[model samples]
Target: MTEKKDSPSFEETLSELDAIVSEMENGDLPLEVALGKFERGVALSRLGQQSLEQAEQKVKILVNEQGENQLHTLPENEQP
Candidate 1:
């Protein structure tokens, strides 16, 4: 799991992952360092996937009403 103390946003994580991948491709980092970067990249990818899934779930699927497709508003969640 990634550390929460300096948690990065989805975009930032993706950018970092891209950099790590590019670096790994260059074959400059040692085997151990490359492996570590690979692990971090995997974790970042999972986090990005999760964020996308959550956003998708929030979207309301369009419905056909009276032969016209209409988009519904997002449901309001109960506040704590």
Candidate 2:
């Protein structure tokens, strides 16, 4: 069987996006280079959004396990 390649975790994606933003913000890259980085940033942003949406859906499911619509807020210490 061929091994499956895993995508980067949400945190890793955000970290890479942050690095790209910092590099672009330095204002030293040529136009072509900046455009390439911008395109990558846009793709990473979309991936981050999808990750967030998936996490939100999971939270909703766990919170409403019994079919109740109420969402109980977890304690600050319990937050990841």
Q: How many clashing pairs does model 2 include? A: 0
**Which lDDT tens digits does candidate 2 get at residues 1-80?**
22235767789889999999999999999999999999999999998998898888888888799787977789999998
Residue 55 local lDDT, model 1: 62
Q: Model 2, residue 38: what's the lDDT?
A: 98
After TM-score superposition, the amount by which residue 65's alpha carbon in candidate 1 deviates from its true location, in angstroms, is 14
Alpha-carbon shift of residue 15 in model 2 (angstroms): 0.4
lDDT tens readout by residue for model 1, 1-80 = 34476778878988998998899999989899989999999999998898777665445332343454555556578433
Off by over 4 Å in 2: 1-4, 72-80
Residue pairs clashing in model 2 are none
Model 1 poorest ten-residue lDDT run? 57-66
